[model samples]
Target: MLTPSLMHHLSIIPDFRQAWKIKHQLSDILFLTVRAVICGAEGWEEIEDFGHEKLGFLRQYGDFESGVPSHDTLARVMALINAKQLQTAFADWMKACHDATDGAIVAIDGKTLRGSYCRGKDKAAIHMVSAFSTANGVVMGQIKTDEKSNEITAIPELLKLLDLYGCLVTIDAMGCQKKIAHQIRRQGADYLLSVKDNQPKLADAFEAAFPMKVIANYAGDAYTTVEKNRGREESRYHVVSDVSHEFQGLICEWPDLKTVGAVVSFRQEGDEPPDEAVVRYYISFAELTAEQMAKAVRQHWHVENKLHWFLDVAMREDACRIRRGRAAENLGRVHHIALNYLKGETRFKGGIRRKQKKAALSEEYLADVLAV
Candidate 1:
């Protein structure tokens, strides 16, 4: 069969340039950009350079009749493409490429692209909220928000775009809103949302239900996990219980609030005076055992460790300064697309940066990743 359509999915993005004025094809531009980014191009100039170097390989997938577009043309095309359309198209591609979402832990979180801010326009750096399927190590979907405080609103929008039929969605304290919980249910998914000062009464209820005495004495369902890495040791103590009826009056506002839990983490790093202990609280629609709760909560950080960290470290995403029009957001999408491809291309047996270096040096390697 012909290489399946990464081309067809991206081709759906409407070309904004005047039809007759177009020199390089939109499909070519889009394909070239994604491939370039995947192979370690960090900016429009680098993308343009990659096109010049790999024009032969790119031609197999796209019509580069007029050859490569200039850096300016690439920037103009990407900066003007409708971001929402791009998001939907990529999401559809991700679904087709992987079938790992059933019963997965979908973690939703936000990260700020620190370098995208523009003092000239006085616009803040774009904050993107991403939904990641931890089990498969792939980004499911993402949406851009104007600020961190807007995560409460962004999570619902991102949720609407995901296929989470049997997944357990997990969010941090910022996503504890009732509307978010209800929306997750609407998406046919359960949720484990963190509780903090954002919801004072709910926080108070969890605090009361899981007192020191109760955590020390209660012999009910509980689980503990230990970790040791690089002279550092940590233990996670997970304890869960039914959302008591006594808190019904307080937590009634939260939709389908069925379980409440706590994770108390103790850590010691090479006898560095043993850092302060940390405690976190949570509420979930799913009635979870301490073990289930522990797994879901632990998996929730995949978004941070796998997606966001790789973007910042491997892709140097925060260092990119493409802050014009929709360029920053669109470039962010490019990174997500490339990251998914790199993560899914498991035969490479190396991390993202190494894969990028190898892909840059070898056309066969790039072809293998793009083909899959």
Candidate 2:
């Protein structure tokens, strides 16, 4: 089997410590940290313990020279490492592992690490914006922001780093800016940006085109889908309308605007009548069919349902309270790397939690996960 590319990427991160003062290899500590995080390590102490327990297994892939470092040493060393370089290294590694298929939706969203907040200090929790490739079922890259409102500035920076050619990128209302649209198109990718009251004229145009007060009489393509989940049934009414000549002048500010899409969902609870219909509008550069638009909209949630939700629940990301320096940010990337490795391992027919348990208990299983 070929060696995992992640191992090679770890070497590029610079070591700030003096050469003679360094005890554990920077690469070895990183290698141990990522591997341990994959096998259920939550914090620095757990990672250090994992390193000591799995020293023999880790030695096969990395040289654990001078034995495992203490939890304090690991935390202090990692906190000093540049978080941006760590993000880049893992992104390059993921690029090698997966291919970008056509028509795939690369969903961009932000999540805050709630537990990273320091009560006594002036430190606020850190928020992260991430690009998740639904086709690859793994995070392509992530950028840290100071707060939720910073997503506007962070989205463009994150888009500049990704390989989005021949793909459809989707972002929520927060990312629906003309500059963001231009950048996505400039990268040779199409964008499906949500339209909300933030853009008053654009929202009005969509509302007039697909008015909820009037009966459905759109001239373009349409598709419907129904399903039940979490004790509720939802019927989605999807419509893709061509940009008529009247609104061409209104939407000319947006780059390469092609179609306007809407998903009106009528939902009902158990043994009750359907509640108020929720309608959402989107502007897309791709001339997507109604079915394609529906799939794109649904897949946009993959970043949340698959990435953020899993991190908080399966990985206990919100539960970790280590906020000294950039330790939380560096370890956050390790969580993504570990998730990619676990997700890439398809041979085991089990969930993430089960796979983590298996890897923790068995050396062979851990090796198999790393071999990915």
Candidate 3:
């Protein structure tokens, strides 16, 4: 059963519509939109259609005395709602549902809403930075930026909103900055940041510390895994070493730097000339074994595979064109809520697309999804 407290989160969202002109309850509209989205509703029209068909199921949670609002009403109200309030409520709700564990992997990454750009209006595509808990497979929180390059600043703000104590935060090379590393440590969490040309000196030092010759013979700490997929075989080789002494000068520039690690990948596809190998380096504050570092680095892709990929492929996020006011941003939040609910439902035993189809075909299954 959905508790009153869980429902209260939506109720507390400050309604922007004036009291005298209000025809429908704010909570009712939000509740309807979220439930409809969970059952595969994409836009305002589809959401309105879902509400009309599933009005009976919706009323089980809240009063629908005025009935489902029109698509225009849904769109207008959603556009007016504050995105920050919605994000705060979403983070709070996720925390209530999933108790984050110490030392859990939290992958931080960003995705661009390609369809949000408007040519005539000269609007830019929206970029959102999201924090995903790999352990729970749910988005902890997200924040939006006008440009992808702003993620360096937006990441610290998003981190400030999350309760990340004791979590191992992993970010891509773009996020590897001194301030971001300091912010993560200040939050009482350790960080694993990828290294690339973005930080030229640091990258050069990392390369110097772990030369290919050193990796060929060094046997201090290492982990290797082989994977086969779609007529291709790939092997990943991970190695870690205590480079504090070797790169003492460079370590001083970073925050809480402890160890440097490298990941080398080799792929052979369809008997074609073996593809050239690729190697990447990373820095971490945690004193982890090569296996642990390898696992953390491997698991970081959960944000890409589980959350971003699902949003683009399963939910058609990249195709959405709602760019009015906060409509695009708010709708993105609704999608996250729906994704989290679907992910939490273990009994479905099917992929996300199949579950969405089932929810649309069966009201009982839809109710089961909302019951959480």
Q: State every prediction's TM-score relative to the real structure.
A: 0.96, 0.97, 0.96
Higher-scoring candidate on TM-score, 1 or 3:
3
Query: Scored by Cα lDDT, where does model 2 land?
Result: 0.88
RMSD of each: 1.8, 1.5, 1.5
CA-lDDT, candidates in order: 0.86, 0.88, 0.88
lDDT of 2 by residue, 176-242 (tens): 9999999999999999999999988898887777786532665568899999999999999898877
Candidate 1: tens digits of C-alpha lDDT, residues 25-111: 887888889899999999999999999998888888778999999999999989999999998887787776666555689889999
In model 3, which residue pairs have backbone atoms overlapping below 3 Å? none
Candidate 3: clashing residue pairs, number: 0
**lDDT of candidate 3 vs native?**
0.88
- Model 1 clashing residue pairs (backbone): none
Candidate 3 residue spans exceeding 4 A from truth: 1-3, 147-149
**Per-residue alpha-carbon lDDT of candidate 3 for residues 185-253, written as tens digits (9 for 90 to 100):** 999999999999999988888778788998877778999999899999988899998874656887778
Which candidate, 1 or 2, would have the higher lDDT against the true structure?
2
Give the worst 10-residue stretch by lDDT in candidate 3.
1-10
